[model samples]
Target chain A: MQLDWFTVAAQIGNFLLLLWLLKRFLYRPILAAMAARQQRVAAALTEAQAKAAAAEALQHDYLARQQEQTASRETWLTQAREEVVAQRQIWLAQARTEAEEARGRWRTELQREQQEYRRTLQREAGQRLLALVRRALHDLANAELEAQMASALLARLHALDGETRQTLAQAARDGCAILTAFPLPEPQRRTLTDGLQQFLSPELNLDFRSDPTASFGITLTTPSQRLAWTLDSYLDGFAAELQALIPPAGGDNASAYDQA
Target chain B: MTISPDQTILFEFGFVRINATLVFTWLTMALLVGSARWTTRKLSATGELSPWQNLLEVLVEGVQNQIRDIARQDPGPFLPFIATLFLFIAICNLLAVVPGYEPPTGSLSTTTALALCVFFAVPFYGIRRHGWRGFLHLYLEPTPLMLPLNLIGELARTVALAVRLYGNVMSGGLVAAILLLVTPLVFPALMHALELLTGLIQAYIFAVLATVFIAAAATAQEQTANLSQSRR
Candidate 1:
């Protein structure tokens, strides 16, 4: 086998050329691409991690806000409940006060109406009683009835105490006077004079006066002392005594009367 | 028939003779360069890759891994030289089956050129890593009295590398030719197929040896420094 130094040199040159060419074309670009891809993948991973951290922080913030809002809502609800209860209590108290006031006014109104009814009943009864008495007096009244009522004067004079008898006797030094609803008959006048002269001095002279509107009664006056009794006076006194003996109509009326 | 592609000169202008070895080498380089350019033209940094691009990436990555494994260092600096040597030799040996195609690797000149490249690359990388003095210091390893033997060993190994490749490739082609003359059919075809296996293996062996030699030279200075420090 023969060696060609020239061809060896050319082949060496070719190998070197091939080395340079392959380095430029193949190794440089492929390795660069691989390295670039690795870097890009790393960057993507890093970015994803950052985004995850941020999202987690945001979630925590949202949770905290939600909890705070819940607490605030609870506080507001509690306060509102208290206010509602307070308002209800005030309303109940006001309603109770208004009801009491209305009841008081109704009671006053009822009392006034009862009093008016009683006054109307009393006036009607009094008028009827007076009419009945007048009618009775017209039917049964005569000189005899007048003389009988006049006889009570003697008893009234006899019932007087010694002090009052002396006071009357001393006051009767002036002439005595008498009043009546009608003019007295002779017999009735003598009877009243005889009865009055027993308590007073025997020298007491009597003056008699009559008025048509006066009560059907006798009245005697001796400047300071006079006495008389008549059928009209006797009837009016009996009616007043009957009214005083009657019981009260209602408990409310008795309490009202006591209060008045 | 001529035994070597170098003897098959197509043209001559004195010593500047154009031979079949140079032509085939040029053809191999063109194929390598063109394919490299084509595949790398749209090199994608992400996503799907074209089939050719995938094939090229596998080939390049395989070379890098092989270099890294043997050298125990970063494969970046030596990747192109080591890979190109394997690709050129393998392609040349594989093409021998084609009628009238003379493989450049079957010539002594091409193998010597490759081995000489390896021989020179060892010192070049070592000197670059540890300076010329540190690299030259490897010749006196063990003792200064062993310097002549060490020099002869270095030269002998370079010759062994060239001869081993050339002998394997040329003998495969020559055996096929001789068998064609003797049996003319099936035996010669079997030998040609066997030559393909041998060719690929020789390419692998040559690349591994080159890697070992270069790695030793690159790291020898530091090893020597450590040993000296330990001894002192």
Candidate 2:
């Protein structure tokens, strides 16, 4: 085939111009839009990931705070319980000490009262015994007949029991001198001395005197000693003798003693 | 000048032709122009068509499919250029059967023009996709020492494309002409059938080469942008 150089050159120029125009107007814009869309998608995905991480962190922090609160609450409850138990123990200890002290005080007061009552009973019994002894002495002085009977007792001294006579003789031999506040004749005194001398040692001295206060009883006085055999003494002796006498064993006698 | 079967005739000023070469060139040009106009005018949004519309659609669709394979991107914008090139070459190639018509593409002048356009457009699209800086840097690839070699290689590719098309088409013509001179009856029928096959094959080769050149330019621009981003 024959080639047309002019026609071919014109056609080549047309093709070049067409490619240039399409590249300029269409391809460049499409590629730019695609790149922009890619960038937007990448940025959006990064932002979403960051927000999700932040949310997860916040959730973790919240859970940690909740756990801490629970722990703190448990601690507070434990401390409160300890305080209450300690307080209760302190109160109980105090109460026990107070009760013990109260019991001790009551025991001491009861002991003191019992000791005071025992002392009062002992003093009252001593006073009653002293009063009864004084009354018995006054009653013996009023019995005069008994004193007169005892004044005649010197004449009947020779008729005394041998044990009684020997006791008097031993008393005379020990340099004892007898003094009397009653009157006696010389012959009678001599007879009395001679009768006493038969059972007495030679160391005896006898004397006589008259006194209305003697009350018909012979009284002997020795140096630093006195012996009186008076009606009051005889009556006291007779009362003691009567009190020592036991009645015959009978139901009536025993019943009478129980009544007295 | 006088025209005879064995004598060369001069027409339209100083143009010379031995036989029907001039008539074939005019017929090829007329067919290309006519088809371009009809295809553009009858393009349907819904794709419903008459026989002529169907023929035009198939040609355009075929070119688009080839471009799609090479570019690996939308071939819509490149369809007109690739389709026009394919149709022009196909018409020129088939015109050899029209008694006195010869395909102009069988000559060095026609193929050289097409190859130079491809050479220039390849860089032009590369510069448009990247920039003038990137287009210039394509020669400096592999290493700076490879710059001269790359330039020579690009020149060789353009020369090869042009020469290969010219040689294949011209050899077909030469064979047919020689055969016609020997046995005009049985040989012309066989030669006509061979020419039809050669016409389709040459047209496809031209379109595929153009598609490959455009694809290379696009790929180079993409690589440049990737390198720049990586450096940053």
- lDDT tens digits by residue: candidate 1, B1-232: 7789999999899889889999999998898889889889998877888888778778878988999999999998888789889989988888889888899999999999999999999999899888989888899997888899988988999999999999999999888989989999799989989999999999999998999999988877889978989999
Model 2 deviation from the true structure expressed as Cα RMSD, one decimal place: 22.6
Q: How good is the docking of model 2, as DockQ?
A: 0.06
Model 2 lDDT per residue over B90-115, tens place:
77787767775666677665677778
Candidate 1 stretches greater than 4 Å from native: A55-260, B178-194
Q: After superposition, how far is residue B153 of candidate 2 from its true place, in Å?
A: 1.1
Distance from true location, Cα of B127 in model 1, Å: 0.1
Clashing pairs in 2: A1-B102, A1-B103, A1-B104, A2-B103, A2-B104, A3-B104, B20-B100, B24-B101
- Indicate the residue-level lDDT of B73 in model 2: 78
* iRMS of candidate 1, Å: 1.0
For model 2, the docking class works out as incorrect
Output per-candidate TM-scores for chain A, rounded to 2 decimals. 0.59, 0.35
